[model samples]
Target: MEIKAYSRITADKMVVNGSTVYSSSDGENINLTDLYRHLGIDYPKFFKMDNLCKAGFLGAETIIRDAGMDTVTPKKDCDIVLFNSTSSLDDDIAYNNTIEDDANYFPSPSVFVYTLANIVTGEIAIRNKIMGESSFYVLKEFSSSIIYSVVKETAQETSANAVLCGWADFLNNTPDVLLMLLQRTGDGKIQFTAENINKLYR
Candidate 1:
């Protein structure tokens, strides 16, 4: 049971390497709609995942917008669990660089807001109006079994129909995001196997 999606965002481009679509990228300042159109994703139906948006030309927001919204039946339940290695290092960098005058020594609210890795989940919730359970985890490595255990417990206790889980790590000016939208069938069929999570980037 393996479901995977991989996305890459650089200075002026967005790339989605996944099953539903082969590849897609766009230039700088093209806006979300244009990026989606270039990626061949349905526009109106893809209004979700905006929470993962980033601040720059090509950032997390671009990745989330490009990933499109997960397609689930109405009233379907889902949990969004995200993990990042550096946890808003870029925001911290920006905050640290915003100087020159004593009056502006304090961090800007906009940049400060993104300093937390978990803030992206809230952005997604606000955009899609999703009120389901949400969480964030930070670890040296993304262990499949560890995450699987967490997901299992969340599903059993909350009766969640699905789990949008993945690793979103940014380092040294490079960001890598891999997301898996997993659904739990009534038969307890977990489509994502340990091996699948291991091969998420592939």
Candidate 2:
């Protein structure tokens, strides 16, 4: 298997392959909703997710779009594997903050829905009708070993034919969402390897 397409979204820039797709000038966190709008994506549910999910969701959406593989394989053949340092802790803290002091206590289920890291994968799966191995993980930092291992293992699996995987790491006020689409065989520039992943991640 190999990477058919990839996209990286930093705090101020969005790059696909070696080309820049979008760049923000204000130097703030990337406004996911606005970027989604600019991309003509109007999924209302996207607005309901926390920042972590938003980053992952947007990254997956963009990569799949650029790859144009929505119909290349059956829905059940698609998989999504993601990794991040913070998991959903950012949203956990935000959800906790809503009810910490009690004076302004508010516990909203909408906010509570994204307390788990897997919710990011869930959102992408739902949006794309993906029915294969959807997953998410936490790490001390981006590990090419972990990404390479999981994708390689999945490639050897029997069911999955196409996969969207990588680091959707949104944490500590820095967002790094890099998603790569992999297929059994395609016009992939390079084969799947830790070195190739590290090069594109940078």
Candidate 3:
């Protein structure tokens, strides 16, 4: 597989293919909604997503658009494989807060739906019409080898034409995301490898 395009999002900046596309002001935290509006994206459901989903969605969307995949007809030949360390703890805390107090018990189904880390992949798939295999793995920490192995095996076993895979972790109002679009045949020069993945992630 070849790396077609990649995007990264941190607390104060968004980068695509080694270039800084957007950056927040000094000492100011990056607001996902403001970034969404700044990017001119028209997805309304974005406001309803938790921070984890928003970070992952924005990363995936930026890479897809950077790779010029958004203009093409949606296809099911692409798979999504994402890795994170938090495992939806951010949203889990919010969900728990809603039900912790017995007198104020208000379990929100909307918030409950985002308690799983894989929900980010589902949101991206639904938006892009990607019907291929979608998986999310929570590792103790970022492991480039594991990511490379899973992505390689998934691509080979499923015979998928492409794959969107990377790390997305958000917690305590902090975000660290690195999303990449990989394809079997493309003009891109970056080879899909653990070393390259590690380099780009850093």
TM-score to true structure, per model: 0.66, 0.93, 0.96
Q: Model 3: clashing residue pairs?
A: none
lDDT tens digits by residue: candidate 2, 93-195: 8889888987998887888988898898888888888889877778889899988997778757746888889998776666798888888888757787899
How big is the positional error of residue 50 in model 2, measured in Å on the Cα after superposition?
0.9
lDDT (Cα atoms) of all candidates against the true structure: 0.54, 0.82, 0.92
Question: Best to worst by lDDT, what's the order?
Answer: 3, 2, 1
lDDT of 3 by residue, 1-202 (tens): 9999999898889999999988888778788888898888999988899999999999999888777777347778999999999999999999999999999999999999999999999999988888898999999999999999999999999999989999999998888999999999988689999999999998
lDDT of 1 by residue, 111-155 (tens): 666677787766655544546688888777767777767766766
Candidate closest to the true structure, highest lDDT: 3
Score residue 115 of candidate 1 by CA lDDT. 70
Give the candidate order by descending TM-score: 3, 2, 1
Better of 1 and 3 by TM-score: 3
Worst 10 residues of 1 by lDDT: 49-58
RMSD of each: 6.0, 1.9, 1.2
- Prediction 2 TM-score vs. true: 0.93
Query: Which stretches of candidate 1 lie above 4 Å from their native place?
Result: 1-37, 40-52, 55-76, 99-106, 186-190
User: What global local distance difference test value does model 2 have?
Assistant: 0.82
